[model samples]
Target: MTKKRALGFGYLPQESKHHFLLVTPRSPNEDVAVYERFDWDESENQETGIVEDNLRVTLDRHKWNSIKDFLTTSFNNRLKENDVTVGRFKIGHVPIERLLGKEMVLLMWAIEDSDPQLISTAIKNWSGLSREERWWLFTMANAITGHADDKRGWRKAIRFALTENPIDDEDKSQVNMFEMFYKNVK
Candidate 1:
């Protein structure tokens, strides 16, 4: 059996049981931030000696909307404060039915380090992707966010989402939610 390589970006999470990386604006002068999103892969994290003093916020089932509002406002307000006319990070918790305009999409977009052509081409051609590829991406998103309740399981899920193909026989319809969402994103 081959070892599964977790992919996507990984950052250190906060010490609390529920933590998420806060994507903070760099300064009051710019909308283009020096920081985008934090990476969250916990397995290699421990191996690299990053198990402590790291944090991101996590919300219970109830706090999703509120936190989403806060993050969106934070991203928006910082831009306004800096007098930026474009480039907004209106990120928030997305309802399963709504499609894009959620943290998932924002995170994918905020990958400032990925190949620009890759990102742009991928996004542009999103609707053109095969059903299986779209399903894999959505399943990856679900796997990243909706996995086991513990930190380890959470980390593992994060790794899997980043590194592997999420396609499987389970939840094909749910996966299509992402497909519909991505097609409507632009």
Candidate 2:
């Protein structure tokens, strides 16, 4: 029997394979590029770890900082839950825990083309969202524009809703993310 692992929202119980996000930081670590790769044929892999990855998004150091703390805290918490040792993210591929990959990708899609100055705002709005809400947003985004390179449709809508429209913390509690997303799309 396959071992069942704790998963995040919107994930099927049977989907337990790990997805990795590759983070490549330029010299001086000014600009960072993040990529996601999913392996379809695990059994075919023999020796080489090489795999094709989609370029999700690139973040400047400032923008990366805005979300780093949140990712670190939440990711580490997830690792602890799975009885894995939490470690710092070096300049390489980081194994995303369960559905955290979805959350990270969704957030990145929202701020990929946004103004760097507004990243804090995006992070604030993103952090206010419940995990289920984030998962739903990710699902919709992935359904239409899951590819890292795709910048239109749901990807654009996510950016518009998350960065351009700032939701106050109090209002966020009552706000429906789906409605917000649809408003942007429409």
Give me the candidate number with maximum lDDT.
2
Give the range where candidate 1 is weakest over 10 consecutive residues by summed lDDT.
3-12
What's the CA error at residue 83 for candidate 1, in Å?
Answer: 29
lDDT of 1 by residue, 1-186 (tens): 332221111111332222233333334333221112224344543224222333222332222322334445543443344443223232321111111223333333222223333333333333234445544554454455432232344344433333232333343221344775788996
Q: Against the true structure, candidate 2 has what lDDT?
A: 0.65
Per-residue C-alpha lDDT of model 2 across residues 28-75, encoded as one tens digit per residue = 566666545454234554114434345556666666677777777876
lDDT, model 2, position 19: 55
lDDT of each: 0.32, 0.65
Q: Model 2: residues >4 Å from true position, as ranges?
A: 1-15, 29-31, 40-53, 81-83, 169-186
Position 155, candidate 1: lDDT = 43
Instruction: Tell me model 1's lDDT, rounded to 2 decimals.
Output: 0.32
